[model samples]
Target: MNSLPDLLRLLAVPAFAWVAWRDIATRRVPDRVWLPLLLVAGVALLFEFFTINGSPTRRFFLVRVGLSAGLVVPLSYAFWRLGGFGGADAKAFIVLSVLFPAYPAYRLLEFSFPGVETALGIFSLTIVTNAVLVGIFYPVALAARNALAGEVSLRSFVARPIPAADATTEYGRLLDVGPGRGGLDLDALRMYLRWRGHTLEELRADRSTYRHSRSLPEERNPPGDGAIRTTAA
Candidate 1:
């Protein structure tokens, strides 16, 4: 009951759908599908070219195919770069040159038109629709993900100051330190230092002037009774 053109038209939807599915599942569309799709598009174009009456209409179809190819290739490349679509989608569009040689206008119309203005109008509308749908869906998906995960707090994003070096200091800020290993808090260390007649600010100002510095002394063994030793010059 169905004509050959009608069969081809129906076939185009499944072919494109398969391309989208394969890309979604494996991040790739197989060459088997793309190659046949390209060939089918070429055959469809050839069929349309000879079957249609008037030399002017044939030239129009060819011109539209050229324009659509030119537009779709670069635009698809941009989309691929943005992570919106993959290389397979662009190739699929190129194969569509057979089915929509004139494009947007050709897609909308059941029959060929004398002028290309209708095609241009349809192309513009298609672009606008795709843009709107992508914009709306992407943000909604991101929000849903963030809500499910529970967003990170602002305080967690900032880097805190390093702590001072001292064992006695009970640094609260360094309690749950993970990355750079823990150290004594300057404020807490200063409190401990103050108990021993020195302030933290004073030690920071001049390390060399400490009345009783807690720094470890260099090791120097005393001379043994049976060991040889050299006297200072």
Candidate 2:
């Protein structure tokens, strides 16, 4: 017979994998995706708690799970509030706290270390640590993609001038360039264009026509004065 812990571990693998995939694809995991896992895991833990018949190990396991939930949920919420984590990320960590309060008995690979075992006892910490370690590579990947696409030079990735035309279709804020650099404040540009009765479609269709009309924040002169230039990729 498979032990309760083993069975729970088996179920958690696919659940977490699905959450991970959804998060990658959509950048959001709906509550519907995590609710069932939380419910199932919570019920399983409760059942185990009552049925253990006064075993100290089982009691300790339950206590540890409770403590993990207490710590992880609030900490995740705090991160969400502070804008460090997305709502989906916070919810996923909270749910995983319930699902894997402690490490599984089965190891994916064996590494002998007392500290690892102790860390695994608060399994949610393991998830966060793993996530942070993985996240450290994201900027590198972004830099590589930008370099490959010629959006940025390999030698000076951080100093690359992103195209003003890229602002119309892309989803991020434009980098602020100082006065006299022919750089446009994207928000100000949009507002000025809108005030002059330009539609989004019109601006997108002829990005260059208005590129020279953009006003710098500190100096708004004639239409061509200190106008931002869009570089060709």
Candidate 3:
């Protein structure tokens, strides 16, 4: 409870969760988050080093910190380079390397807290492996769901179609409706509609105001252009 690493457990849990939520909402995390975190962690670490004078105790702490940081930081960067991890995610793990360094252990009644640790005893590595397991299982779960609903096959296994009415509220790309495009790509149509601060249903309802390729905010209609096909949007 008194150790810097143990105290940081409180900060690490909620901070990581908040970052995940922010990324989900806006698709990007601010670069500023790491700076303050690294500062506080650096100060605490320096403070702990001077305050602990016992040779064996400091050596044990340094060994764990060295092992955890040595393994986790490089692996996190490698995962990011290999495209398995996002930049924010890799940075988060690197922060975890400093914040944790080893599993934070404490006692409650007859049990140990956290209740999990890897064979190598690096806390950050445990998180990465757990994320990998979840990544593997998640698609299997989705595919099982589709199979039970009789939507079997690779396409349905990977993607489930959302209604056009609901599409405006969700985040995804439109799969091109085969042919009969009438010179309109659904991707371009949605971009133009979004730029105009409107929805597909709105454009569908009043094609007269948004009937041509001229409907895009900064784009002009070319010569001999035909009216936008209603089905195109």
Candidate 4:
């Protein structure tokens, strides 16, 4: 009976691993990946409630699961709304809260928390913390790669100045100089210009007209080779 919790915890490991791998490779996790795990977790919780009679552990487990759901669901939704998390990422967090509401005792590196509740009781919080700690290295790795590639000069990397004209688009691709920031805001600019009965070509050709336009930066240079490069714009 004591081993029942351990068994349920062991069952969840592979399912979680599979979801993690799928998310890494494809940036998506299908319903099939988490649904069975959710079902199993539900069954395990019910089994523990009915079969484990000697302690208040079952009620405690229920409370942990409820707290995990209450805390994680709204947090995940908020992250999604803020554009910090995708739909798939939010769902994955919710599924994980159910599958691992508390820590399993049969795992490696067991330790006491002193005054702290066992780390497993707040499993979702640990997951978020671990993710954030791991993610902190990504920008460092990107900077290292850029330095090695010579895309980032040592002076530029160290100084990190706000440039008068950024040569590259937000996606890190080079662009011919025109209206630097305006290029990124082209759609809104286009609608405004069109509303004022001016075509983009007309604006590009007449520097005075381009400068006079509201909510638009003055075009610094003429169109390149008669092409309005809109890919990044």
Candidate 5:
């Protein structure tokens, strides 16, 4: 019974794993996923309070949980507002703060857990710190993912690679034919593609279609306006 709260909190790990997979695939998580975790954490916390037999111990528990939550919620919110965190990621952190307000220390089925803790022993903050530390390997992870899929692009770490046949339907900006692409100076070509509402692949499929346009947006003018009106070749 003494370890019930910690075990309940442990449920959050697998829940977050599902959330991470969903976030990577569709960037969406239904609100329903969090409510159950929150409910369990709340109920377990109340049970822990009731189980406590002394005033000082209960007060200490309250102080630990309250301080952990008070510190994490604001920091997660600030990161979300600054665009440094996704809204789902921010919510995950906040939920984690509630679920694990303080370190979980107990032996379960003969397996000792959390043999050591940070100086503060604030579990929520520890989770955040570990997340930041793990994030340092994200670039390497990206590179590896792209490599395994044979997406050996110069911008593989940051860009998504799709077949040229699906360029019109795919959701991403042109990387190979961007305005800033050097050598061939395809910037003008890029502007022309934008003005004509065409993808580079479409133009390349039949250059004769886009090579002779009725109007060409001047370099200084907005993409929609084609004041130059000289056959854009």
Candidate 6:
């Protein structure tokens, strides 16, 4: 028969693994996984009380376990609210606290005298293993997905804008009529000016408005206005 601490350790180890796997694969750890582990930890504690001969120190350990479990609930809720940890991660963290109970100091795993050192070692090992798995498999999976999809290289999709002059020339080529094409047609320009509600003859009568009209100054304003206002030539 496994001792109380041994069984607790075993239960906790696999719970940690399941939580990590859930996060890595689907980025989720459901309550089903951690809730059972929490119950198992509780049962392990009850088993310890029944099987092991009591001493004041053992009773104190029981108290620590109770306090750890108690603290886990609120801490988990707070972390979930703050977005620091997901529900499953919170449950996993709670399980770790219950399993290890000594904060700031980790416990080294063993049947007797598990302390903060072991907890730290377990935490460190878990991190390393998760890192190694992600590093090895993620890139390979990405490459395979890209290959199956027949993804093109990024360079092929790059779009550099043509220079402004080149862009204008290309547009002109499409609309080209012939060499020495005359400037804007008077009738079309006049119709467009009327559409914009501009009166060409009225604009010509005013120096300020005529100068600012869209038509060229010589074409629309002309020298006639100044010529008629003679200052003895």
Cα error of candidate 1 at position 225, Å = 74
Write candidate 6's Cα lDDT for 1-233 as tens digits: 33555546575676677667656554445666767776776676666667656688677766666666566556666767886556666666667665555322323554434333543234323433354466567656655665556643432132222343233112112222248774333334444444444454555477585565454433333222111111222
Off-target runs (Cα >4 Å) in candidate 2 are 51-53, 107-116, 136-173, 176-202, 207-233
Give, for candidate 6, the lowest lDDT window spanning 10 residues. Answer: 224-233
RMSD of each: 21.9, 9.7, 7.6, 10.6, 10.1, 25.3
Give per-model TM-scores: 0.49, 0.60, 0.73, 0.56, 0.64, 0.41
Please identify model 1 stretches exceeding 4 Å from their true place: 1-6, 103-137, 152-233
In candidate 5, what are the lDDT values of residues 5-88, reduced to their tens digit? 777777777988889977665455778888888887798788788887899989988998898889888988987898767888
The superposed Cα distance between candidate 5 and the true structure at residue 15, in angstroms, equals 2.0
Q: Model 5: runs farther than 4 Å from truth?
A: 137-177, 180-233
**What is candidate 1's CA lDDT for residue 14?**
83
Candidate 1 lDDT over residue span 46-134, tens digit each: 77667768989777767776776676666666777886655676566556544555432233346653234553633423443465487
As a whole number from 0 to 100, the lDDT of residue 162 in candidate 1 is 34
Full candidate order by TM-score, most accurate first: 3, 5, 2, 4, 1, 6
CA displacement after TM-score superposition, residue 164 of candidate 3 (Å): 2.0
What TM-score quantifies how close candidate 4 is to the native fold? 0.56
| Model 4 residue pairs with clashes | 103-120
Candidate number that wins on lDDT, 3 or 4: 3
Question: How would you order the candidates by lDDT, starting with the best?
Answer: 5, 3, 2, 4, 1, 6
Better of 2 and 6 by TM-score: 2
Per-residue lDDT of 147 in model 1 = 52
Clashes of 3: 0
Judged by whole-model lDDT over C-alpha atoms, candidate 4 comes out at 0.60
- For model 4, residues 1-233, the per-residue Cα lDDT tens digits are 23585587578778777766665544445676668777877777677667766567767877888888888878888878987677777777877777667764543356532234554566776676566676667666666766766667544332232243331211222232355532233333434554555565665677675675363654533332222234321
How many clashing pairs in candidate 1?
1
